[model samples]
Target: MVSLQIVKQSNAGIASLPHGLVVLFIGATSGIGQSALQSFARHAPSPRIYTVARPSTFASHESLLASLRQSNPTATYKLVEADVSLVSEVDKAVNRIIEEETKIDILFMSAGFMALEGRKDTSEGLDPSMSTRYYSRLRAVQLLLPLLNKAPSPRIVSVLAGGLEGPLNEQDLDLRDPNNWSSWNSSVQATTMATLMLEKIARENPRLSIVHWYPGPVDTPGLAKIQKFGMSFPNPMSQEEAGERAVFFTTSDRYAVQEGLLPVPAGLEVAKKSGGGIFLLNPQGESTDNEAVLDEMRRRGVDEVVWNFSQKVFTACNVQARESKDEL
Candidate 1:
């Protein structure tokens, strides 16, 4: 386990990074995303930070940004209002960024929730939980790839289950069948599919450093809401601790494909890359091997299957969104 002390010590060097690093964050309205945003604002030197929030949360989020501005007067924070559970809104959010920025150095995504009440489908006919966790996140990545590639050292940090990938329900990739759909099944499906798709993207974009992290049992409002359903952890990491670790993941060269970000932490060598050339990290900040399952999936060509299905979903969502606009 990479101790928290080492994590902080490594992150202390964020002060040394060049100014004007552009970063875009989704799902920072609350929970881990919010904490990570705060850490980035506090540490990185004069970073141009963009964070998204839904209409209802925009006012309060702006207030939070105001506080961040007071602490880091050199940083620029832009708030984009969008309900990220829908791919259409994600597209708009990305387009707005593309219009202003030439390149994006970091893309940080942690937008998702556990639907303890069961599946709630968005107007685009996708379960909001899966859409938020998988589809919308991937949509943002797909749209932002061009800008990401333009950066000297691009990094994408996705906070979700990284090492705990499980067997995919190949027969029903989206869990559309009522018989196969459950809260647990959807969460598993989202995490597994996300890892596979991200690995495929890594192969295609060798310069990009992608880290999938599993932050075990964080103390946040999201957790408080779900705890009534019998979910409990004996010792959950504090939000501030997780935020600091997240900053390390975001900026440390230890997690990068090539040495570009801040130097690898003093006593740490670069992390071992997965077969797909991405980082699958455990809660302790150590690299994990899930090749027993991932290798089998890749051999079966499930990655291609996932890519095709995702394209179809995006097409359908685009059509629906356009139709809604026409009606308006």
Candidate 2:
């Protein structure tokens, strides 16, 4: 386990890196994403940060950004309004960023939730929970790839169940069938599919460092909601702790494919990558191997299957979005 002390120590070096680093944050309105945003703003040297928030949360997130501005006067923060549970909305958000920025150095995504109340499909015909966790997140990455590739060392940190990927329900990738669509099953499918799709992207963009992190249990509003469901974990990591570690993962070369971020901490070697060439990280910042399941999926061409399915969904979303605009 990479100790919290080491994590903080590495994050402290963020100010030393070149100024005006461009970062995009999806789902930074609350929870782990919010915490990580605050940490990055506090430590980084004049970073130009863009964060996405829904209309309902925009005012509150503006308040958060206001406080961050006071704390880090040099950093620039822009909040784009969009409901990230919809892929079409994600497209709008990404387009807004693309219009202004030439390159993105870091793309930090932690926008997701557990569908404890069961599936609620959006107008786009996808469960909002799964859409937030998987589809929209993937869409943002897909749209931002060109900008990411332009950076000298680009990194993407997705906070989800990285090492705990399980067998996918190949027959029903989206768990559209009610009988197969338990909350747990949806979570598993989202987690597993995210890992597969991200690995494919990592391989195609070798210069990009992608880290899929499972933060175990962190004390946040999300966890509080889970507690009300009569489910809980003991001694969950503090939000501040998780945020610091997340910043470490974002900036430290310990998890980087190329050396552009902070140098790897002493006594720590670069973390190992999965067969598909992305970091599957556990809570403690250690690399995890889930090859038993992942290898078989790759061998069976499941990665390609996922990629093709996702592309179709994205295309459909784009068509629908354009049609809506025309009607408007």
Candidate 3:
């Protein structure tokens, strides 16, 4: 049996943030991303936070901002209105930040979705979920590399399953085969890419700390969607098969599902309270690196390959990565 380490809240592994930390959060609208946002503001020394999201969706998030302001009245919040899942939009957003700010200490890339269908390619002709989950997030890192390097104790955290990586369909990197592609398949692919790329980027930019987190099952709104749409992969137990599946998460069955709406405090609290390692924040506070896989990524030129391909993806999309225009 694999020994699973469980960290309790009382563990001494949590670390506090420094003052005047300039952090950028993508996918801060909901789920684990939102959790981290709320938690960071609550714990970090007053920070200048810029979150990238769509303008149409901004009004819906006012209540969240209100609560966050309540927790940390001094928190400086800026909503960079854009669709970060697109390379063009990501480039524009980062450019805007660079134009304004001198440096950004932290870049949190957690924008992704658990799509329940086969590949839905974007206008850029890239797989939508994959683009959002891996490509778009990677683009943010590439564009912000210079700014991240300029900061002290620079860190890039991508919240996805790194340790739980599975087989990569190298032959079909895009996973376009309708027969083979599924949401779970896409997730597995995204997870694989994130694991390989994080190690790759960490190696190339040795000065910057790269962390890809696997926040173990927290009952967030996303979980409800996963339950609703049914997993892309083989789900062993549907609610029909087992009441536990339906019974456990069935409390919110009353609300209308209009294809939108979405956190909880756990993720933010975890991000606020983490310290060492390329942190994969478990339910509790501690983190541990998967040395075996990381070592392999180093041995293989996977990082370079991934980065090259990623840049090619952005290049093919004709996205211009411009710095932000805001004053520091």
Candidate 4:
């Protein structure tokens, strides 16, 4: 877990991106996304914030927007009503952002939640949770790569587990494992896959600092989503602790100020010093460079295997990364 001091320092500082920076946020309507926006606005000096969410969520989102505007009148908040879980919608949204902006400094994705119901796939043939949590997040990152690359210190913060990776269910990378296919399994699979994939992307595009973080827990409207599926995380303490950890992660200042409210803390700082790789971050806004895990992966030599499988997934999705020309 990231320490309280790191989060406090991050939250307390008045920071701004290198001037002329743009940001794109997915899942901005609730949970970590909204909290990240507020925290980013707390210290950011006039940032252009674009968020994608659904219409029903937009109403509540609007209220949050009002509060943010009230906090920082200079901030520009653009709410894009779109179901980010859909690859097509993500494609359209990325294209829209690219149509206007020359570059995007940060692509922050926090648009995911757990489902209690058995695996549900979207019209895109993606499992519901996986669609929103993993594929959608990756799609946004992939779609916005060029724009992000344009920035001097381009970064992508995807709110999933980065450090807590597991064996690449080579057989069921999609978690179709008939033996166990519940939300618990899905979360683990998604987290592990996301962690490895982020590493792969970092290696492929060293210029882009990719960090996947597990935002301990935040008290958001979306928090109750898991129960709707009629299932639990199976680990009540972890869930409870995650919620508690979320508070510090969002409010902390050390990583927040350094990373600049990109969402979930990042390994940007850590990766910068150690070379490009996924920064497995915890709630208090610190990176976990679990050398053990990295060594193990290196020993197993699954990086290529995981990367190849992910590329197949991304390829099958048929999405192209685009740069944003929009200023806001």
Off by over 4 Å in 3: 1-16, 230-298, 319-328
Model 3, span 202-293: residue lDDT tens: 65776666666565554556666676765343433222212111110111111101111011123322222112124443322234445555
Runs off by more than 4 Å, candidate 2? none
For candidate 2, report its TM-score: 0.98
Candidate 1: residue 241 lDDT (0-100): 91
Q: Candidate 3 — worst ten consecutive residues by lDDT sum?
A: 247-256
lDDT of 3: 0.61
How much is the lDDT of residue 175 in candidate 2?
Answer: 89
Candidate 4 lDDT over residue span 1-328, tens digit each? 4454544544454363444457787876766666666667655677787888776787888888888888887778787878877666777778888888888877777777776657777755567788788777777777777887777667777777666666556677777655767777888777776766676677777776666676654555565665555544443323333433443443233223244433444542432221226556755446766566566665576667766765676666543322122322
What TM-score does each of the candidates earn? 0.98, 0.98, 0.74, 0.77
lDDT of each: 0.91, 0.92, 0.61, 0.64
lDDT of 4: 0.64
Q: Over all chains combined, what TM-score does candidate 1 have?
A: 0.98
**How much lDDT does candidate 2 score?**
0.92
